[model samples]
Target: MPMPKTIGHQIHFAKTLSGLIRRGWWEIPEIMASSCMAAIGIVLGIVGVYNYEKRNGDNKEYKSVYMIMRPDDPRVCLLNNPVYTQYKRF
Candidate 1:
């Protein structure tokens, strides 16, 4: 049969656990720092991808001769062209 614990035993156990945590809580900070670094890495990657190909010098529209730079620009030619979005420098 297992020995039953009293209130005093439970209190002592709690006190000991608290003391251990107080003295050796390095893992908590380590986990937090790693997670923060991973998040920073993800944000940086997204920014890099978003800023890629900023200029439209080399970006050419598949069929549209002129990019839709204004509201009056022709859209019939750019309708099926996939490169129309990249053709604009905006």
Candidate 2:
């Protein structure tokens, strides 16, 4: 025999509520919230990688040709190295 419509609805509601209470059915809202957080984290991670690349892309070499001197030197030694001169204005 077919169940009454109202009774069917009530049974379905009870099943859904029971599932929720038992942590059986993770519904759309929970899935959406988790996915949204993962997406935000991915975007932030990409932004961080892009910023890191942008900050360090130009200068790959750490070698320097200038000699260090005391600040009390009467005449400041201007670094005349071509690489140093070209990058000084940057």
Candidate 3:
């Protein structure tokens, strides 16, 4: 057995929620678009941090090849090799 006040509160909450949905405040497409935008924002933030560290050469595990500006450069071939090597200053 539920109290009358509790029932009233539940009804009020449901009505409020339904009103919000009816008013297009909680639409499916809007939710999906917002979710996608949030996901993209998160990914962009992660990529920005990665780029920042890459630019600063903070990740010692991955050697930064500064001289190899071109993608087709012979030096870029080193990136494909499985063996990890120490950073060499040219």
Candidate 4:
């Protein structure tokens, strides 16, 4: 008889965990990359949440969403300048 899906998954997970515990899993590139990517993703998610809160707080006008692209900005000026647009170097 076949094992139930949940039970099978649990058994597989336990086996994998046990194997990792026995033989330091950090030496494995796959595990290192997975852990690094997960950590980066979590940090980025936190920064995103902080940005959202700051952008949409009670003082919305004080921190306008377009604050990054102020008209006086050099980058914005370059974008608007016809000469810059005509010969845009990749």
Candidate 5:
């Protein structure tokens, strides 16, 4: 006679879980690569930040240029853009 549906389903699920647990399933290369990718990214980021800080050290100064576009500012026509300058000596 066939086993009851409820018991059969429970047994099937348990077998799948047991197989995965016994097989070191997480070590599957695809899974491991994807799983460690985030951690590796974080470590690399930390290393980059540490290197940057070590090189730049304690000077908190940050300089940035904010460009404003004015309707009257003829530069918006973009003939003055660096890209155009590269085509010929300015």
Candidate 6:
């Protein structure tokens, strides 16, 4: 029991939706490849951050790699370790 104007609008909407879907179908492979590469990059970055360790002294327990460079950064680790304990003063 729909009016003629409503039927016409519905037909127009369906046609445009189908056209957009058809165009998107061709780029599915490229979209999937990009997603996979982004995921791989994220995993590699995580591994690098986790395995990295930089300590001030050679005999000291390992502090975070970022502690020396960004001591004030609360987002990184903050131990009582000195910034340059290993280096000898000239």
Top candidate by TM-score: 2
Clashes of each: 0, 0, 0, 0, 0, 0
- After the best TM-score superposition of candidate 1, give how far the Cα of residue 77 lies from its true spot, in angstroms: 11
- Writing each residue's lDDT as its tens digit, candidate 4 over 1-90 gives 997566332322245766765444534767767877999999999999898877654333233354456767765643343334354375
Instruction: Kindly list the per-residue Cα lDDT of model 6 for residues 1-90, writing each as its tens digit.
Output: 976554332322235876655555554768756877999999998877666644323333454553245646763454444555565575
Q: Quantify all predictions' global Cα lDDT against the true fold.
A: 0.58, 0.58, 0.61, 0.58, 0.58, 0.56
Better of 1 and 4 by TM-score: 4
Report the lDDT of model 1 for residue 85: 52
lDDT of 1 by residue, 27-82 (tens): 37676678779999999988777776454324544545655466466645434445
TM-score of every candidate relative to the true structure: 0.32, 0.37, 0.33, 0.35, 0.33, 0.32
- When superposed on Cα atoms, how far off is each prediction in RMSD? 11.1, 11.0, 11.0, 13.5, 13.8, 12.4
Top model number, lDDT:
3
- Per-residue CA lDDT of model 3 for 15-55, tens digit only, reads 57567565454446688678779999999999999988776
Better of 1 and 3 by TM-score: 3
Once superposed on the true structure, which residue ranges of model 1 sit more than 4 Å away at CA? 1-27, 53-90
Cα displacement (angstroms), candidate 3, residue 77, comes to 26
Worst 10 residues of 1 by lDDT: 6-15
lDDT of 5 by residue, 35-73 (tens): 579889999999999998776543322327546577787
| Alpha-carbon lDDT of model 3 | 0.61
lDDT of 4: 0.58
TM-score: model 2 vs. ground truth: 0.37
